[model samples]
Target: MIGQQAIRDWLFINGKIEKAVHILSSLHSPDDKVFVNRKEKDGSTSKVPCPLALKDYNSNMNFVDNFDRLKKDNQCDRKSHKWYMRLFFHFIDCCVVNSFIIYEELDTDGKKLTNKNFRREVYTGLLSRKLVDVQSPSILKKRTKSTTEISNHKPHVSKHLRLTESKHQPTQISSRRCAMCSTKKKPQRTK
Candidate 1:
């Protein structure tokens, strides 16, 4: 492949001047141009100016092939009938690969992480981060209750016991997100 740094050179093949070439380096960038043979609609061989990257791609594709191989080695692909979900998993795999590339660049220690290990570390880190609740307090104030409590069938409180207890203070109640409801679905409209 013709790299971005490769010097400009010309080659004559079949009497057409072919531009740059690549041998020892990776594929060339999309900046420069090269003349290559193209079949005309009239069944005549024509010289076409092709992008160096395109020419390099036509010759040998190592970058994309290597990246695909790396991603496939430890992919986050999930079996899903939904096209969007499959795309989402593939997106996740791409993100992992991107992050791994950045990590490789920033890493200075002698010890380096493999792509699989990097993905594992990333998964563990995501699982380990503290999750924050974004639900509003108004929605959280009302929570699920037992049928007996909801029916208001509590035993009558003794006047003396109530007087002895601090009625002015509010009691703290534990609340959590419901499995069957959210801010959007199953909104709590009734007390």
Candidate 2:
């Protein structure tokens, strides 16, 4: 993680010169350097360079730290996602941060809204636009109907039911009338 700062000294490993290091200059500032330190096993220390130069730790965070803070603040740092879902969540967070920056930059009148406020406004806008729709009464009813339909239809295998007897296992044959055809009575009827 070597930053764009020009190092006057060579990189040393265990009190020996390893190589001459120089970070590529950035477009914003050529002189800025994000510096880090690594403690060697011999009790000595070495400078660790970062690729992206950032403001002082007291003033502003680096890209990595800022992203971490955003995830923490937004409560989007969930550990339950699969690999692809994790990538998607990271992309969403990046978009959110990008949107916040754009919003701040576009405000000509200089309206100062905190990150939380901006996020809340974004969420409200999404809800209003139906982009993030919640489970409404009508939708809930439809979902319940679909669930009942699914549950009424028995599966081929009932793994959860540990029936020791072979005769106890569920079978398609039943002495009931088909729900779809009320007048028809068949040995194997499905509701």
Q: Which stretches of candidate 1 lie over 4 Å from their true place?
A: 1-54, 58-60, 129-191
In candidate 1, list every pair of residues with a backbone clash.
2-28
**What lDDT is reached at residue 130 by model 1?**
19
Q: TM-scores, in order shown? A: 0.40, 0.36
Q: Which candidate is the best by lDDT?
A: 1
What count of clashes does model 2 give? 5
The per-prediction tally of clashing pairs is 1, 5
Clashing pairs in 2: 1-49, 1-50, 1-51, 2-50, 3-50
Q: How much lDDT does each candidate structure score?
A: 0.62, 0.53
